[model samples]
Target chain A: MPPPPLPIAPPDTDPPGIDQQTLLAALRARVARLEGAGREGHGAAPIPVCEGLGLSGGGLARAALHEILAAEPGCGAAFAAMLLGRAGGTVLWIGAGAEALTAWPPGLARFGLLPANLILLRAAQWSDALWAMEEALRCPAVAGVLLAPDWAGDPAAQALDLTASRRLQLAAEAGGGIGLLLRPDMAEPPPSVAASRWRIAAQNAAGAGQGIGDPCWRLELLRQRGGRPGGPWTVTWRAAAGQIDRESEALEAESA
Target chain B: MTAPRRYLALHLPAFATDRLRRAEPDLPQDVPLAIWASQGPRRLLSAVDLRAWAAGLRPGQALADAQAIAPDLLLRPADPEGDLRLLEGLALWARRYTPLAALDAPDGLLLDITGCDHLWGGEAALLAEAQERLWRAGFAVRGAVAGAAATAGALARAHGDGPVAPSGAEAEWVGPLSIAPALRLDPALLEQLGGLGLMTVADLLRLPRPGLARRFGVDLLDRLDALAGRRHAPLRPVLSPPDLGAARDLVEPIITRTAIDALLDRLLDQLCAKLRAAGRGARQVVLMAWRVDGAVQEVAIGTGTPLRAPAHLRHLFRDRLERLEPGLGFERMALEARVTEPMSGGLQSALAIGGRRDEAAAQLLAQLLDRLRQRVKVRRLAPRDGHWPERSVAALPLLAPMPEMPVGWVRPDAPVLLLRRPQPIEVVALLPDDPPALLRWRNRPHPVLRAEGPRRLEPEWWRGPGVARDYHQVALASGARLWLFRAGPPEAARWMLHGHLP
Candidate 1:
């Protein structure tokens, strides 16, 4: 476990970088700067995360992994659940395909997510999805919204501004709701004012871990808002109870 | 690509719902007919006038007096539900003109006939045909056409014939006409003009606008300038044009239900396949059956659900086909789904239901009931949406589906389905803190087999009285149960039948 492998930083990027502690400090400073600007032309309130939340290392790979796992909770149920958990808003799963709710990946409910909080919006096209998401966000009743591909697109700046200013995150925090963004694996994630991003991948067990099932890799956090990227960490998969355990023993052994 | 050559505009009255309700079999042509919601003339919910002649009928017109002067006038209850459904139907009808038609209101529609207008002659011919069809269906319609919206609206309101202002004649057509109401001027401006002796549209056109602006404001001047074709005003067309729909000519029209059903099945599949391929589903479906003679009989069904499944959707229209009259031999059939929703494939599981929720079946059943109610009369079907004994059920539209309650109503642990309008019930109860020993409803006394305690419901203190009640669910020995409630404060309760336990 030789500290896993660090991401290949852009050339002339201070070679191999500093230790995780120093990188974390720099990222934290940048997030604070952006968060301070707060969207309303007024200064934003400090991000109220407790001291215990994890941070990503200077590696993009680590950031991506942290973002996905933190956003999505139930790996087997639907990626939406994870996103909702991370974003703190409701999830609206919609599509003309099968039952939108039924199609959710497994293991969501096991993590204590309720379907009532997740709204399912129906749309006829990409444009409709955007309109639906914008409308759903205006509703203060919803904690936050997890817009499945059923709600995505590049809408007019006015429409986007309406959703952003609603402070959907604040509503979710106040009402205890979560919003998730579930999209196609190949989809170029639409430009949104999302707090973070993660690309999920399925990981296989090798060698002596043969008897265990393949654990899912949330990969690394591509981007995160207001929080330092947590260094790349492997989450061991558990099914009946969907919990991702960080391999602390492996990390320590590698560091020594 | 070539620019669209023609576009047709359809205007239904802002109050078309009220108009449809008061449509009469016989009324002298051009005579003003107004429909205002009433049940013996108290409040005028809305008024629809056939002729755009007088600017009278102020907001406070006494209903009885208004009807007294206009004897041959028609009046009925306002139906918001019916209006939405009818608007949807007309939207489907406009599809025959062009697939680019979009809803403009509960009343109006905008269609980009463009190259398609020639199919029904030219734009003027198309507009005429539209009015003719609506007139046959008992509608009083006024229409006009022009290259730009401002000029068209002005002409339409003024009863001037229009297609365009004719090259270099923009000022001539709009200048002479009086300003109409839709320009929505401030009442103060009109009042001030009335004082200044400027009464008619022609008067306003003659006035010096600079003086008017100094006295009133820039608003009136701007409106007058816009309508006079001096200033530019753009039309906000409600819908982006959609790709034209596809239709196949049948070899011959089949009269039999099975053949018709089979044809619909095929057409539905074809239409749905195209929708899926394009990732869309239709919200409105049009079924056209061409009789042996040139006339076409059409039955349209609006879907609360977006189109995706062809088979289930085909079943939706199966009931409708059985009801249509296939007069003479059939020659052709066409099916079109007008409003579409996004179509995509995903591997998600069914939504997790907290309890036994038969949403799909309930939806289907509601649809059937709505259709039956619509055919018989909209008043026949009522839907219950509350836990209160009364005011729980409401008259609903046939085409619209009932939305799911976010949470099954949080009813107090009391059993009974209250009537929409509570009926007073005679009751003989024990003293305070005691369950009812006997209750008489509909002129009969029932011995209480199992008496339940009072579920006290205080009146909304801030609102008013009339809502003060204490409810209870009582079971009679005769295997009959009743939801009983007492009106008044807790200290003085008067019993009534809040609802029945069905």
Candidate 2:
């Protein structure tokens, strides 16, 4: 919650003679205080702050990097759309290289995101993709950025090191847009400055052994800044609504 | 009233040789190089370098004779067309000094620098600047400014180099110059004048006009009057292209990144202020850094929205700064807004609850698009004036709104992600008319928890592929509700998955 301790390396000072960072920090603190007082300044940030855990009542902080680890092929994208969709802003989906399909993958509205509002950007190169994603996050109009770079072929570019995440975080903060990085891995993710990290896997819903029931997935909260960090919870991935539902009668959540 | 016109004649001596030397710096300097032209029965040298002239090989010499004098003489065929094009290009660039520039053909540019000279700190400074630029551009030039185009051209060709003849000085300006170029006479007339031993322009002025006209025709007297400021013949200057941007030239070339950044800040302030004054906004900014070595480094930045604020423009330029390929050191910098839009409603609106949110979303998306161009292709869906399920609506680009649709029309509830091609699935039904009880897809069975649809749609002959389909919205045991359709007759019906209902 206190930000996993600042990195070992001290914050690098700003360029010589232009000490804007100090002023910037002071302004940020003042803004936070003003927001705390329930008074928004002119041109309020596009992305609203999150209440907690999921993307409801402000699902994710504006311009924050959120990594979703997916064990299954399509679950991470589906989950990302589900969250950003509910946040109700323009959505940008960036897929780097030919690894991504041409068409928009299914299940955007199932989580409450409008399919029409989704803007799909196909990047020819990984660097272009990363740059565009960061640029999008820095724009006030964009609500979310979903970056899916080519991880298998170009790990050097795909690796979301802490520094890269920090850069994305800075861009996101500038425009008050949310950033979501979807990677395919069930294990602990590499070090990153993302505010929230999740792991997801598609699983059989109860009694969905032969016949498909409500879509169920193993949803794990690997790291959340202010949330239950430990989780292997089974939640029904409502295919149509694009939300994680855990109801007693319809959902029946189970411990993974 | 029309702006008063003053002419500056730019004489590019050795234009071909100088241009070729600049293009091929590795050329042998010691060799006598000449641009040759075929004149009827023999190949004659049209232009020769100093080395060739020093070897007693003058222009118009037979190519064989020149080669005999300097056995290793380098003779390149002259390219008159390319030379003319280069002259025209320089005329265009002269706009940096004045708005009116004209080509004198062969190897000269004439500029009307009547009022613009003050901007460069006076006439001398302006002439000095033009001369310095041409020298830097690898041309050996003779420039002279005068009230008359003919006087300026004569002075530039004969006696003056970077000389300025003030107003009403055209007659005196040509007095001390040579007769050959001052008269601009044909070779035959010049030879006739030489027979009389009249070589100086003053000698030509001393001759009676009636005698000169009887000997040299009316053109000779007419040209002499134009050169002496007795008559005014307007120069047909090439249309001056508009320069709607600002540029800054440094006293000393700069190579350091910090200096460039500081320079950029000043330039952005200037450019954005200009845009703001015009009630216009710029979408793209092109930064060109003219290096000391005569090279130009250019970088262009595009913004998602019309930008009038210097800070945002600076931010956009920051990302593209890496693209500037500065060679040596930069001596001049220019900022131009290549694309512009009228600033709409002052760039900001009252922060309405929904409007702010939409603006923010649009801004973010636009920013992303600006960085990664051609990446996002939004297929916009809009209601069309049709009745068929597929034809009733149209998918277009987001920028184009759909036309009016039929009244009381509403888009039916459908899956957000629809399969463009319906995938086949095995279905089991209790009765031919009843909804499917179960279906199998991807080799997995889906038990029908509920069946809701049989919304029958008939084929429309007006639309092609006019096949009928019995559409159904079925709830599966997997909790995934799908949009399905049956094609062909009931006796041999086939079911396919069309989409999923959210």
Candidate 3:
């Protein structure tokens, strides 16, 4: 019997020429050099995703997709919620498939997003999710939208190739809304016309135990339309004051 | 002030047997036929047709006794349900003439012909038209028209044919009606009335009403007052089909698309204007076009949200309007806004109607919904009180606000997409209790790369017989993340694929 094609394209999944050990060492060395750049005079500036990588906000020339790929089950959702809480408007999460649901208020509040302000819509088809996103983004009232395609893979999800992403980009432009896409840790996103795309994976804090980690992630900015997207950066989200802070000491020590 | 109402009573005295005879048209009219049903021991006749009445066969007579008196009497068991159903169907058919039609149970209909009778040239012509139609439909209907509902019912029962009592002469008209038909009393009371030589309504009215109440029951006085038009009996229609709809008579039979579109626009503007004044918006709009050849073409459109704007509402009808065959030509068009919601502050404000962006987004949704040829609906997921992950949530075709999940709600990652039903799979597990390492689903082998905890969700046993499930998040080597559950306890378990995560 012949073997079926592999689901993940090799180049997309591992992002060629960088091992985990080498990537971590490089991120730590760079973090030591640009540590205080994050806590700027502007108190609540978005935490920089990576070297030369900023969050998609405030005069980006166009509305775009901020893709976050998680290393574990709940990590991507938490990371996506972090970006959503700072979007400054009502957030719509489409098709978050959880046992009960992913819109747990207290679970998301720790990541600094209000579940009350979030409205969840479910679509059996990925195409319907895209359609739902387009309708929601036509009005400026929606500051951002997070889409979790409910279907695994079928003709329904096949509707969401590059073409579907392009349509979302156009709709966000019209409504001036930002879109965030949450994919599984190893799942490959089809070629999308997203203005910006970043991959995020959960990283345990020095002492993560008993409960989930305190929202630390290794973020990779793979795509940025006009600006240059470099390598991975370690980002930490603080829940007490609802802010994102950069950690450089661990990165510096790892490099040494 | 509300306009004075005129009601027409359609009374079928032999409703059960009459409906049976009509259903079987070959039944000989010369035969004495009565419907009989067993009541405890003996078969008692429940309904008798006209021929049975002439042959001395009556209701409540035992079938054998009735057969002895009239040797060839036809006996069929009484069907009261069939009788009521036919009567209600006839009442609904009467909606074409007047929107207000109510079924007076066992066998009667009260039609409020107030302003509608004029459309058939007058009350007498309307009654005759309906009588002719009912006769053609195999019903022996006694129709009577009066200013009051009870008076019409009493008059129709008394006179076996058409009888139109004038508005002011209600008392005089029922004055001569026999007391047996006017007010049926107990045999004892009836004998007393006969002994007193009071055979007609006039005799009872002539006697002091307070004295009559003392002799008989107080109901006799209420019945008499209702018949004399002194007391009003409110007609309880099945559903008063409202006059909320708007219709138009075209100057010329419209044949072209432009003419039909123009008429629809005019009708919608007028209809929505009235709806707006009533502080309501329509959720469903029906456009019924009565063609010149007497065929009615209808187009119905439903919306996710209430709508009142004429252009937006008209746009919804464009696709359905194309499907409406003009046939010869349409003579009139009627627009009905059946389901409505109260729109606050009259018409929707142009900017930020409810002072929320969701309202604007919802409005924008209408435009996209109009262009899409799919059945647009808002699906909702609500957490049901249960322990099983499969039974923990329910789906409804509405967008109800999600309440906060319970404090301790937690489970391993489940799929956002659920198959219509859990698919049982062939599995080869590395261990007895762990999730299957290799499972064949839909004729394909998916080897497990990594797996998560066996999140145990016990069945809600209080509900019914159910097996507890051990759910797992399995990432197949093909990069598929599936929520698979093992049925029953770990000692004896079978695998079933349930959900798919993104």
* Number of the predicted model whose lDDT against the real structure is largest: 2
Q: Write the per-residue lDDT of candidate 2 for residues A6-124, one digit (tens) a residue.
A: 55874597547668878876676675454332122223443432222353223455556888887643556566767676656667777766632322332354455554556667676
Error of 1 at A240 (Å): 31
lDDT by residue for model 3 over B1-502, one digit each (tens)?
8777798988878778767776888988888888898999998888888888898988878888899889888889877777777777777566556778898776788998999988889998998987776776667778899988888888888876779888867899899999887675666887889999999998999998778899888988998998888888887776556436887777688899999899899999998898888888887788877665444566888765567888888877886788888877876788888788877764332222112445555455344444332332333344555676556565532323455655544332534445546778788998888667898966988787667758887767788887777887766655446668888666767888776543
Error of 3 at B269 (Å): 3.2
* Residues B1-502 of candidate 1: C-alpha lDDT, one tens digit per residue: 7752333445655345334543444555455555566546477636556442252443336667666666555455567677766666566555556666555455665565557767767778888877776665555555665544444555655653534444234456666665445354656666666677765566777778788789878887777776565675543433333331445455576678888888777887788778778876666777776554334567777654455566656756866776677776665677766567664561111212222144453333333332322222112112244434333334333323333432434232323122335567767766765667887754678777665556766544554555556767665544345566777656766677644331
> Residue A245 error for model 1, in Å?
50
Candidate 3: list runs displaced more than 4 Å: A1-76, A83-203, A208-213, A217-235, A240-256, B1-3, B12-38, B41-99, B129-140, B178-200, B240-243, B248-266, B276-307, B315-502
lDDT of 2: 0.69
Per residue, candidate 1 scores C-alpha lDDT tens digits across A16-117 of 758888987777767755653123221222222212225332211100111232222223233334334333323344332222222221123323333333
Candidate with top TM-score is 2
Q: Please give the distance, in angstroms, between residue A241's alpha carbon in candidate 2 and its true position after superposition.
A: 5.2
For residue B259, model 3's alpha carbon misses the true position, in angstroms, by 12
lDDT of 3 by residue, A105-185 (tens): 344545555544455565555556667777766556666788764324432433457777777776776666678777654
Let me know the TM-score candidate 3 reaches against the reference structure: 0.58
User: Which sequence of candidate numbers ranks them by TM-score, best first?
Assistant: 2, 3, 1
For each of the candidates, the C-alpha root-mean-square deviation to the true structure, in angstroms, is 25.2, 12.7, 13.6
The digit string of per-residue lDDT tens for model 2 on B297-319 reads 56877665676777767766776
Error of 3 at B47 (Å): 5.0
**TM-score, every prediction:** 0.38, 0.60, 0.58
Docking class of 3: incorrect
